[model samples]
Target: MSNIFTEAEIAYLESQPLGRLATVGPGGRPHVAPVGVFYDPQADAVVVAGHAGSGFGGSRKFRDAQAHPEVAYVVDDLASLDPWQPRGIEIRGTAETFSDGGEELGARITGVMPFDAAWLRIRACRVLAWGIDGDSFELSARDVA
Candidate 1:
């Protein structure tokens, strides 16, 4: 894996606890899920982990990724209400669904829910970040190579 995110972007991602993952569902519809977010530098990808039960390896987003392979993830926050500020990062990429990582990485992912280690790994093809490069709330876009 290659590093496509900047230091600031990585820091911002790791600091955030949740993200929205959008996957292609049945009939080409969009299915979005609120997920526990983690930036795994070792994997060089954004890892979305959530609860999985005995009957399934993961949730709907995982199934959709396995079927469609393309997905989008966004992590955002209201930096301030006093002055009305927002900051966020959006990643569009190819997604992979996997099980059996929980034992090793469960400690790393965020969220209060208990997870079975199943995760959706996103290999970013393009990334757009806002309010991260500096104090300015401008946007920065990049293509991962």
Candidate 2:
């Protein structure tokens, strides 16, 4: 797929450290969590790092991604509280969990302590964005590639 993000979009993604990740559980229940993420320009993917083998096996998000590869992730913020201008990008894609190659995927985005973890790689298939322009509020959607 050609790069799904424009220059501005890429900058925005790199600027943001946290994103809401949506995944479906084995029973088809939706789960959302705020996760530390980074945009991997080389892979053209969003990477989320989580504790390795935390509770039963791994994290809920990791298990959920394994059960259901389809997921949605969003990063948004209010530019102006007075005017209530909100801007962000929503990414829909397939996720793959990696434990063997997660060491280099460490996230320092939030200044969180580093630890051994598994990484979730979200390969963008579709992207939707809104309110990127300073003065105009518009929504745009496009398929990757």
lDDT of 2 by residue, 1-145 (tens): 3267887888888787789999999779999999865777768888877543443127798889988999999999887899778999999999988765554445443334443556778999999888763342788888984
Tens digits of per-residue lDDT for model 1, 21-93? 9989999999887876788787789887665453335467778899999999999998888887788999999
lDDT of each: 0.80, 0.77
Q: Please give each candidate's TM-score.
A: 0.85, 0.85
Clashes of each: 0, 0
Prediction RMSDs, each to the true structure? 2.8, 3.1
At residue 83, give the lDDT of candidate 2.
79
Measured by lDDT, the strongest candidate is 1
